[model samples]
Target: MNLWPTYRCAGIKVVHIADDWSSATVRLKLGPLNRTIFGTAFGGSLSAMTDPFFTLLALKQLGRGYIVWDKAAEIEFVSPGRGTLTSTMTLPPEEVARIRAATSTGEKFLKWYATSIVDAEGRPVAKVRRQIYVRRKRGSC
Candidate 1:
């Protein structure tokens, strides 16, 4: 599914998505619709920008034989976000291997990933942590 248009209309842009679904980069541009009363980036938008990447990446790596879902999330506002804010989510091959090994027996596994939203000048604006739940399907490899 194409989410770029929907997110971009809300001022969040999906700048890049890897062919292998191992990484993705998103940018949120400060605009009237996405600005808070103080004229900075809205907290909800910042959190929303980071909402799906981890789960999506995990699902891709684990394939259809596994169930992947966003279990929980937390965001810390480190500074007032301004200008174009960017965050990149990555799922390294090693991490993918770990998840597969852990859930190979059809047991559930929870994994956490962290990403930082940065301003155009590369200053950290927010820190986001996402926890994902994964389990191998009962009858699948």
Candidate 2:
């Protein structure tokens, strides 16, 4: 679901969508709205980079009869992101299947996933863990 434009509208840029899964790389050009007091990228902006991908991918591959939401989250800032930050997200087929199987009974389940934010040199600047909560639709397959 085209979240890139929405991100860009707020000054974050969607760099690329990997051919594998719905994992995408999104970057933001620091501006008044997103700049920190010292003029570096704001923590909130950096944190927001991990927002949409994993759960979106889960929803798409998981198909109907399920709802996905961010359940738990942790972000470790390894360094202050100055410029050109990139975040990558991916999900494997088996993981998708597991989540699906676990929630097939209309019971809610939480799944853990991760994403890494790297600098232009490909060194990790931050690691984000996303816990996705899923629940099945009533009387639906």
RMSD of 2: 2.3
lDDT of every predicted structure (CA atoms): 0.90, 0.77
Error of model 2, residue 96, in angstroms: 0.5
Model 1 Cα lDDT, one tens digit per residue, 32-75: 99999999999989998888999999898779999999999999
How close is every model to the real structure, measured as TM-score?
0.94, 0.85
Best by lDDT: 1
Error of 2 at 116 (Å): 1.3
RMSD of each: 1.4, 2.3
| Candidate 2 local lDDT, 27-82, one digit each (tens) | 76666777778877777777788787788778877777788898888888897776
lDDT of 1 at 1: 33
lDDT of 1: 0.90
The 10-residue segment with the lowest total lDDT in model 2? 1-10
